[model samples]
Structures are given as C-alpha cells and as structure tokens.
Target: MGMSYRRYLYGERVYGCSKCKTHLATIHSMISRAFNGQHGRAYLFESVVNIVEGEPCDRPMTTGNHTVRDIYCIKCNTTLGWKYDKAYEVSQRYKEGKFILERNLLVDVQ
Candidate 1:
C-alpha cells in the first residue's frame, strides 16, 4: 500500500517506509502555509543520505561558503532537493521568513 501523506499531516509523526519499514522524519515548511497548500499538506521536505563510493567534485567553488540541507526518501533513498542557507537568507530579506520547499514533493495527482 502507498504511504498515507494525509495521515502524516494529521500528527502521525512516525512514517515507516512501506517497502523497507524504516522510520522517516516529517519535515515541514518553516514559513507560511502557502507552501503547504501548494504541496497539498503542511510541509515539503526529506532526509539526506551520504553518497558512498562517489567521485569527489573537481569543480571549483564559486557559490561561496553556504550550508545546504538535502531531502531524500528514507525508504527508497531518493533525493528530493537541496535547501541552501543562502536561499533562506534571501527569502528572509523579502520578509518571506525561513522555509524550505522541495519541488519534487509536489504530487501530480492528475
């Protein structure tokens, strides 16, 4: 059976992966609820996993020093999106507050 996202919205904290039965964390937007409406729930986020056996980046760093949070699927280990600290700073500058929205979390229910 598919995961019940609706249930997660209603205070169901522990989300066990249907396939692997691993507990998943519930991440929500730190800003307005508008993101919630767009995501059809109260939050849009994921977990991050270490990429093992991956080649090191050879590209030069041009974006400056910034911390990023990556969202991933706890069960399938799917990467959702990266939330940069700079992004939050920019949003705050526009009075948008602090919030991370993962575009991949939006379901195309059509």
Candidate 2:
C-alpha cells in the first residue's frame, strides 16, 4: 500500500471526522442539511476530502434507489457516510457525484 496523505481544510466553518478530526467538508460546500442517515441526520455536500470511498452498490432510499459507496475517514477509518454514484430518479439526479456525511459523525472544526 502507498503512503496516505490527508488534506487540511481552511474555511469559516469546517466539518471533520468526530473520531479523528480529519477535515471532510466546509460549510461552503454543503448543499443541504435536511437529509437523513443510518445514524440520524445527515448533510449533503457538493464535495468532500480526506476520505476513502468503498465499492458502489445499489441501495433503496427515501428519495429513490441509488448506487452509493460508503465513505470512510482517512485518519480513523470510521464510516462517516456514503457517496452517490448514480441516482435512479430524475428528480434526484442532482445528487449524483455528491457526498453525504452523518451529523453525528461530524465535528465543527472551524
């Protein structure tokens, strides 16, 4: 395995992995906070960093069926949330290529 390097984010409000404090996303990138996850509330982000994406698989969600991959914190390898690879619903197409991070798994690092 190659050596892994994590990126540090600088923003007015930064969100990170609660377990390891590794930067994930910033407030500027957040699209919505009205989402829900397995653990509870989740936030949708336009982009994210310092994480690893697992294999994509089909999953049925409240909105619709989607192909998603579980995302893990690079520093601690904790399951933070998932990334949308393909959205099956036309109305949910906007979520493709985006990421979701569980609120309970995040910590404000600003």
Candidate 3:
C-alpha cells in the first residue's frame, strides 16, 4: 500500500530514511504534484527537519528540466534530496527557491 501523507500531516511527528533515520521534511510542508520533475512526473515536497548538505554543480537535471544541486545526508552521505537552482516551469518556480526532499521516498517514522 502507498503511504498516507495525510496522517503525517495531522499526526504528532514524522521521521526519515530506513538506513540513516535522518530527520527529513514534514507532511505539513508537502506541496502536491502536477506533472513535472523526474521522468516528466509530478514531484512534491517542502522544508526539511534537520539541515542537509547540497553539492551544487553545472550538470543539468531531469532532462535539463531544471538546474539542480544534489543534496545528501550530512552524516551518512545518502542522497536525501535536491534543490532547483533554476526551473523551466512556472509551476516549478515556487519550489525553485526551495528544497524538495524525499521524505516520502524514505521510510516514514512517525
């Protein structure tokens, strides 16, 4: 079954990652998707819990759909997420200035 984002949004707490347990983003900050990002799929997220490290580079991302910097877990070097240094879509513009984490990608501990 798919994860219930709504529960995490209303529930007391949430956590991240099965391997490292790094405190990632929250459900409250989640922005629902509308067809973009990886594989032309719609991606969603907002702020993170503990700050992570981003390795910015010139390489284009998601089929040059975005100018991106890869984010990693400071402690374990696991790829926590990324940020859009620049975006090609207006719908993506709001997130362009923010970090999009994969808390949902990880195992939610709440």
Compare the candidates by TM-score and give the number of the best one: 2
Q: For every model shown, what is its TM-score relative to the native structure?
A: 0.31, 0.97, 0.62
Whole-model lDDT values for every prediction: 0.34, 0.96, 0.57
Task: Judge candidate 1 at residue 94 and give its lDDT.
Answer: 35
Per-residue accuracy of model 2 over 1-110 as CA lDDT, tens digit each: 99999889997999999998999999999999999999999999999999999999999999989999999998889999999999999999999999999999999996
Clashing pairs for model 2 are none
Q: 78-104 in candidate 3: lDDT tens per residue? A: 765676677776665675756655534
Q: Considering lDDT, where higher is better, how would the candidates rank from best to worst?
A: 2, 3, 1
Top candidate by lDDT: 2
Candidate 2 residue spans exceeding 4 A from truth: none
Q: After aligning candidate 3 to the native by TM-score, how far in Å is the CA of 44 from where it should be? A: 2.3
Q: Tell me, what's the RMSD of every candidate?
A: 9.9, 0.8, 8.3
